[model samples]
Target: MDQKMFCYQCEQTAGCAGCTGNAGVCGKKADTAHLQDELTGALIGLARAADGNHPTGTTHRAMIEGLFTTVTNVSFDNEALQRQIRIVHQEKEALIPRCGSCESRCGRNEDYDMRMLWTDQEDVRSLKSLILFGLRGMAAYAYHALVLGYMDEEVNQFFYQGLFAVGEDWSMEELLPVVLKTGEINLKCMALLDEANTKTYGVPKPTVVPLTVEKGPFIVISGHDLKDLKLLLEQTKDKGINIYTHGEMLPAHAYPELKAYPHLKGNFGTAWQNQQKEFADLPAPVLFTTNCLMPPKESYADRVFTTEVVAYPGILHIGEDKDFTPVIKKALALGGFREDTVFRGINGGTQVTTGFGHGTILSVADQVVEAVKSGAIRHFFLVAGCDGARPGRNYYTEFVKQAPPDTVILTLACGKYRFHDLDLGCIKGLPRLMDMGQCNDAYSAIRVAAALSEAFGCEVNDLPLSMVLSWYEQKAVCILLTLLHLGIKNIRLGPTLPAFISENVLNYLVENYGIAPITTPEADLKQLLGEA
Candidate 1:
């Protein structure tokens, strides 16, 4: 029998149209998506089984690994998905044994159908969606930190709480707070990751990165980890190979320790979604350290290598020792373009600045606070996140363009490309728009917020700041959850709410934290500025 594929796993599915015929918008075959769902179902069962028994270290790691595998654009192998499902099932069966010496057996230990959560009321669905997606996002960061041997106790406990809520039958009243808590817990997770990263690579400092690619062999490294890039730079030093930044990894240039390297050339391409076209026929090899790995096209597939948690079939994997020899060899064999090649971002700018981590932001805190007090900085708009190819995502450009002149925009992730190159003028010797690094660097935003709150002797929400966010993947989900956890209110999120959130869950958000979907920029800006 012929079957059709139907999936709505990402923000930019066809027609905002969930894939429903034979493959996902992401090219996930129907069979693969089904296996993913099965994996998810088994995870819920494992979570339920662990409800009273308490998840051990092994179970916690398994839980995180299982959920992370199903995030959109992460895995496509049916065999891998099935193996994960089997793992979850095994874990569940081990955690909760069958009814012993019972006359009649019941389905109490059975795996739950994920569709039940999907088909629930919108608000209920939305809140649970927040918990699930937020955890999926958190799992990525936790996994990254885990690889580095840094783990937070509070962060790990919340993972269990968030997953347990997903399998719950609670109403909006019950799940909505949990939804917001997802954000809260993610804050700790991001903090843990930030600690893991900065301690491993030193705190990031501001530095300018060129867009000019030097002649001869070079490697391009992308994704959100500075430690991996630092290791690659160390390994590739004096090896006749240069390293460039791609996507979120561009911020590596701003960190003093990383910038101190002579061979760390320049940036190669733009955001994650553009990889298929950007890396096509490129003369140098590229390495992905984390998420947003699209199935590599044959033209550039061989040139791509993955390290840490990221993996692609037939692509080279750099393991625990973090050795990057294979990627360097590939770069040498490619020999790069004969002359210096200049590439511009979408805005045609030749360069970008990054490394504005919490250290840099807090260092300028007095200036920022005085500016706010003196009315020099009237508003702060955080315009940042992963950028996607969706048509309406242009809302970010228009939103940033229309932001009032008195506002200071602090951005992160690949989404800043929408307008990062635009010269918005400066506020008190600081650029009007400052990039705080990649998605994981949202921790910087949190630190800045907390410091501002301390300086003003008030809560972060009472300050004249508003979060205008755009999300494209699991990392964004965790960041959003972190925001909610902080009790900050009135966040404007768009281009569209996740398809995973149900209406009742959406209502819970609206009623409790005033979280609302993004409308037109004019409307959102007016509402944020109190004109609404």
Candidate 2:
């Protein structure tokens, strides 16, 4: 079939092959998709140029920004994408200013067209897609850390290596290792971001956030950037406006310095997918700090503000200055609800608890070990990742709701919104359901799992821990790769496998890692419990 565009970088691709229609499933137009491909090709060229030179901080930042611009739902404006392409080209020129005018032009430094990778054999395409998409996700995490004054040489260099590999004429034998290496490096990237966050903001603690919106003007801050949320909170302080967290930003309520702001109220909406409906005719403005931004509806489009790397065609973006005055004005102008408006989570509960990062959990590690030994905690289920708009996503809610009384639920990202408010009673002295911060905080889960394995004198997979994950975007891609890279096995991934994974690649994963797409929660629960 002839198509204007080809994209399978997201979970919502068409027909589980690629988005080859006039518009992608995520509302990306053909022109925008083509521009994104161009932008990616330009980034590969930049990586190619950086091969022999020592890339400066500016080079690394540009590469990260360019990769992140191509992530799904991050940038929809063709003009913005074209601008990114120009920036990449400028970086490449700065790295090798004489390459363009060389007498004997060697094609080694030329930009690689993405169509070549897209049209390769299925397995090759799948492996390259894994590397490309994983790099995109890791770039976002690295960008966050860079903003907070943290940068890792290894993590920064991997961007160039991975991107260069994507453009290489390498077979599966060569590319496969690089694909796995993407996961290996992403682990470092996530850890860097974790260090930046916990150091910038204090270590997170168990904090209960309300779903109720008190009467007053309020701005709902969404996405996963704590730095952005903190700046907004500071700017809006004592301005007679309340700040509410949304989507992945819900965990922001647990940060000590952020929670200190009295006007920083509770969570507002659910996950990112629910924004269109939830933000419709809302009295206050909504500010997006990162990805999972759906196209704003006309109803509330005027009140939507984007900051940092997130951009839409007409949305007002708060620049690097971190000034949030426009968002505040919009919030004050809307003049929120006449009285207090109470909102409940999907499970019909009024409050959800967050924090519970590695620091908090490890602080009580002895108690957790004792509870397990005493049989009060039978198992640990990490039901985490981004929340999607698919029909079966409620499987997470059901899985958490039906977990055995003796088991504990550790969750992260917006997926926890499915059951975050459920009043699952405690085991020993800890709440059965623990929110482990945002998707980036998957590092915390890894740390805790490693510590638990050391405490039990067994491999991580040998422990009574299960990973039941739901992925919606590229961030989830990098996190899943990190899990695979660590040799963690028996992972259950769903509500649907990525369309980009060819059947052969899926088989390789299944046969080697025992990764299975989730079925019914009851059946999977039985299998995970060794009863199937």
Candidate 3:
């Protein structure tokens, strides 16, 4: 409470303790952080109000909306946070109509003071943070599925249950199960999303996306919403505006529904962290559909448009109508690169491949199994998670590079941008480095791991696969929890351990699950391969 604000939910938090100064490393200000906490507190109250009542669809959506807004880099507008807070309070009031007029009132349903959680006993805070952050991440996937008209009663209900638990005066024992259940429930959530996406857009197929900005106006879309991209693609079809995926949207190029748009030319830049430099003086408008949006610099500020839960103070926002006219006009006026301009990924390659989803991978299960049996494939590495601007992220690049040729690297999310362009060649005709769609497609990895386990007659952990993950924000938290819930151990996480994990809680992970912070790539690779 004494500091300007408190935020340590991200990997890049100040000093690996907390970000309590004027701004977080993500470029979010103290005031915005404070507003986000207030919004979270209001959501806790909403969940508390729904404790004994059957929450309506409206209530379910409000819970998802409010939680996703607080995700690390999602919403930076104080007014937007205030607006979401008002909606949360209204939903809570609807859930308990006369709670406001209680004559002898108890404060059971009042908005929580987030400072309590931030200032709680360390271990208790750690457990609650896991549940809360995990819920926040799961909410994002839920929101995406919701837009595509997919709903799971269990997933919707867990959001309320998770929020209520966060507000309770409970011991660590009471909260720990909820922490892992957050993972259990998220598996369902991720599956629901995978179903929604694959059903709406036919299962993704392997495709190569170029990094060139063709000579014409183009709009760059960042973040994780495929619905938004589909709508934008439909709107811009044959309009002379080329659509380019950026950041997490890079995986969009692999989906049949999205890739069918010829104007959906290719990917534009690298991960979200590089946007400030990538978008500066750009000749096209950039649209952000979800998180990982940094504060825009003055140079590119006018061209940044946001939609859904993503909002910046002054950026033009495309609302529910999904109209992309402003974006189209801006692109035309700028008249993108007068000539076809070539761009390269971080590794200097002009193109990258994606869409090796569970469907595709499982289709060739026989071949993969044969490869492993014949010693053509030696190991499997799932190098996936959100990418950030941290210097230590170079570990992922090096990890992928040093992976033995006989091993297959399965990656998803923006982390692939680090070495996405690298040609790791193939093992027994299966690309050694396979991209299994977006971070949401972690389900693909889970499915493949399960299928492999079945084929090999062993536990997934007993398989040759090792998870080397890097995280930046909330979605990563939920996915990691899902991994733990599945009892899959020996995950190597970096660039740093989460700041909210108390020493005791961290030890619990290490002691029981073998969760370890990443060390040097040489050391980790050797140890994972039994060469150490």
Error of 1 at 105 (Å): 16
Measured by lDDT, the strongest candidate is: 3
Give the runs in model 3 whose Cα sits over 4 Å from its true position: 1-3, 100-107
Worst 10 residues of 1 by lDDT: 99-108
Per-residue CA lDDT of candidate 3, range 1-532, in tens? 4449899999889999999999888888889998899999999888777777778998899999999999989998999999999999988888778845422123478889999999999999999999999999999999999999999999998998888888998999999999999999999999999999999988989999999999978999889999999999888988888999888888888888788888989888888888889899789999999998999999989999999999999899998888899999999999999999999888889999999999999999999999999999999999999898778999999999998889999999988989989999988789988999788889999999999999999999899999999999999999999999999999999999999999999999999999999999999999999899
Q: How big is the positional error of residue 391 in model 2, measured in Å on the Cα after superposition? A: 1.6
lDDT of each model, Cα atoms only? 0.79, 0.89, 0.91
The reply for model 1, stretches above 4 Å from the true place, is: 1-6, 86-110, 121-123, 314-323, 530-532
lDDT of 1 by residue, 1-532 (tens): 3356546657876676467777777767777777777777788777667666656777778888888887777776565667677878777766766643212123245677877876777667766777787888888888878877888877877776677677778876787678778777777788888888778767888777788898999988987667788788888988888889888888878766788899987788887888999889799888887777888998888888877546666777787778788888888888988999898877788887777888998998899999999998998888887788877788988898899988988999889988887778888887788899878788898889889999999998888888888887777887877777777789988888877665655676688789988899999999888888
The digit string of per-residue lDDT tens for model 2 on 178-232 reads 9889999999999999989988888998999999999989998887888888888
Clashing pairs in 3: none
lDDT order of candidates, top first: 3, 2, 1
Pairs clashing in candidate 2? Answer: none
lDDT of 1 at 43: 80
Clashes of 1: 22
